[model samples]
Target: MLQTLKLLLPALIPSWRFFDWIAPSPRIEIKVNNDWQEFRPRPDHVSFPTMMKRMVWNPYVNENLFLASCAERLVDNPADQHSYEQILNRILADINDQKVTSLQFRLAFIHREGNALKKDIRYVSKIHDVSGAQA
Candidate 1:
């Protein structure tokens, strides 16, 4: 068990950055061996090399009734050599480097209106868009 934990430490640990060289960065790089010479190249040279979307929580959208967040944007092209997983890891590393863990607290909403009335609110959680049509 100890040996397994030690081996898996790198992947599980949160990567952080430092002004000094003591703390090394988590570098992820991927190489594809698609021989261009052996195979015929596609007509569209402008094809995206990598694409990914990040879904993160939005503090601005938080309310006493609901919580909401959205995808900021879609990254169409990233490093050509990096795979999707590699790019994800790189992004995670950057986020970890910038973010600092802190304590969590609960906030209550206090409102006064309508004869000083309070109503219990219930929100419906929709998982996804289940349209009949294909994506």
Candidate 2:
């Protein structure tokens, strides 16, 4: 069933972002001391990351049909802004409570260009300062 849904999702939704035509990847980066590293759920961690991604991509984040909405701004929706902020705060607080010095989010996309085809981190969003953040 899941596989069928995944295969048919594109046809049901023609929007590129909705279909994830260009893979948009997100990673949480945490700073410890002076160095930064990727943050991953513990082996025991539950479905938090999946929930976060879903919340980020929910349609309430944007409704401006005029502007092309990028996957990076998933949390900028007006309707779900407050809820998204709460979820974000909880994640940040959890990291900080675990003694992480700082936190940020990085979003990247994979695509092909004129002559060469490659997969790499093409762009990263602005660094979010979650150092000593309570929320």
Candidate 3:
């Protein structure tokens, strides 16, 4: 009975170990007009009301989170074509400019080193023609 109770105790109690080990996360960057930018850039400043609203309903934020998950998958499996295609489709959908004819994408691992953040480029895809490609 004591052994059974000990086994069940852990199940009943919650372990709030959220940050046991901090590691780098993968980020998707798209090259647009000779400049590379984050696929989904977060706003620098969000108001208290806006933060509360986003916590309740924010499709864009959710989509970005999904994309981040896909990026992590890509990092784990470099030959993951499904995740690669999903990221490409997302980038194509976001860029609706007529002037941009070609673009490239790369996966970057972002991590905090000491007090500074650093980005290390992992994979750089060949330039893709946007004119003939379908998202």
Candidate with maximal TM-score: 3
Q: What are the per-residue Cα lDDT tens digits for candidate 3 across 4-122?
A: 99979977996978779987877889888899988777889989999899888999888888888888888788898988888888888888654678989998998999999999998
Sorted on TM-score, highest at the top, how do the candidates line up? 3, 2, 1
Q: List the residue pairs that clash in candidate 1.
A: none
Worst 10 residues of 1 by lDDT: 64-73
Q: How far off is residue 133 in model 2, in Å?
A: 5.0
Over 32-69, each residue of candidate 1 has an lDDT whose tens digit, in order, gives: 12111111112453323421111254332232112111
Clashing pairs in 2: 61-77
- Looking at model 1, residue 44 earns an lDDT score of 54
- Model 3 residue pairs with clashes: none
- Kindly report which residue stretches of model 2 are placed more than 4 angstroms away from their true locations once superposed: 1-20, 41-71, 74-88, 110-135
* Comparison by TM-score, 1 against 3, better one: 3
lDDT of each: 0.27, 0.48, 0.84
Q: How do the predictions measure up, each by TM-score?
A: 0.15, 0.35, 0.77
User: RMSD (Cα, Å) of candidate 3?
Assistant: 7.4
Off by more than 4 A, model 3: 1-18, 133-135
> Cα miss at 89, model 1 (Å)?
24
Give the Å shift of residue 15 in candidate 2. 7.0
